[model samples]
Each structure stands twice: as structure tokens, then as C-alpha cells.
Target: MAVVFENDLDRDGRKRATASLMSQFQHAAGLCTIIGSFTFLFALVIGLIR
Candidate 1:
């Protein structure tokens, strides 16, 4: 989704907008990865405890 939006901005010749969108998308992806890892670890710990 973010990639598609970024591509559209790039096609429109909005360099700054494309860069901003790419940065935001990267940040969001990083956050999601961190959260997902933590959640998986927490679930694993709970399962092990049981």
C-alpha cells in the first residue's frame, strides 16, 4: 500500500513527497517488525511457562 502510494507520488514528479512517504513507510514497517517480534516472544514465553 505504502509502496503504491509512493510510486504514484514519484510518477507525479514530487521528489520531496516521495521521499517523505518512503521514510514514513520505512518507519511504520520498522515499528511493526519490533512489535511483532515482542508479541511473538511474549507468546512463546507464556507457552513455555504453561
Candidate 2:
């Protein structure tokens, strides 16, 4: 339910919403880090080849 919306009027709902947002942020950060590392490695290889 928190994936799209957190439709609760209680404090737990707000807490869950924050948790979901943080999880999403963490996931995106991990993905970005992986891609950045791969790209860096690729550039390093190309530099060595040239």
C-alpha cells in the first residue's frame, strides 16, 4: 500500500510513509552507485586500450 500511496490518518501511516520513502531513496542510491562503478571501470579499460 505504501508503494503508491499511504492512505492512513494515524501516526503509523506517516512513519510508514517515511520508511517507504527512505527505502526508495536507498534503492536508487545503490543503483546509481553500481552504474557509476561499472562506467568507471569501462572508461578505465578504454583508456588502457588507447
Candidate 3:
């Protein structure tokens, strides 16, 4: 019983860590996508003006 309880706790900790890491990565990817799109639009506008 004690071993099972410890295993459960360890599993929970690992799951929480994985969730947080995934969220951080998702946030960074979103920021990069937004920046990339903005830059693309800016370049397009400049090209049209010229």
C-alpha cells in the first residue's frame, strides 16, 4: 500500500511538470507566430508602396 501511494505521488508530480513545460512552449510559439506575421505584413506593405 505504501509503495502504491508513493508511485501515485510521483506520477502526479511528473504530470504537473509536463503540463507546465508544454504550456510554456505553447506560449513561446504563439508569440513567435504573431511576430512573424506582423513582420510579413510590414514587408508586404513596404513592397507595395515602392
Candidate 4:
């Protein structure tokens, strides 16, 4: 979905599209970091209980 939307830019539109894609990428990266941190924390707690 993101890739499809990103590929439709005209010359002027290309700059906007690039910025939008960067914003999207940053958002996805942040979410992954948060999810990963919590996952590791939970796994550590589970291991300690065993």
C-alpha cells in the first residue's frame, strides 16, 4: 500500500512523496523499537519466573 502510493509522484509531486515516505518510515521504525523493547522485557520476566 505504501509502495503503491509512493510510486505515483510527478516531478513536483516527487518531493512531497519523498517527504511523506520518510515520515512513514520514521513512524514505522519508532513503533518497531517500542514493540521490540517491550517484547524483550516480557521475555526476561517470563524467564526469571521459570
Cα lDDT listed for each candidate: 0.76, 0.73, 0.66, 0.76
Model 1: CA > 4 A from native: 1-15
Candidate 3 deviant stretches above 4 angstroms: 1-15
For residue 22, what is the lDDT in candidate 4? 87
What lDDT tens digits, residue by residue, belong to model 3 across residues 1-50? Answer: 01111222254455455555666677778889999999999999999999
Compared with the true structure, model 3 gives a TM-score of: 0.67
* lDDT agreement of model 4 with the native: 0.76
- In the predicted model 3, the residue pairs found to clash are none
Clashing pairs in 2: none
The residue-by-residue lDDT of candidate 2 on 1-50, one tens digit each, is: 12444454455534466666777787788889999999999999999999
| lDDT value, residue 19 of candidate 4 | 70
* lDDT, model 1, position 45: 100
Tens-digit lDDT string for candidate 4 (1-50): 22324455577755476676787888788889999999999999999999
TM-score per prediction, in order, is 0.70, 0.70, 0.67, 0.70
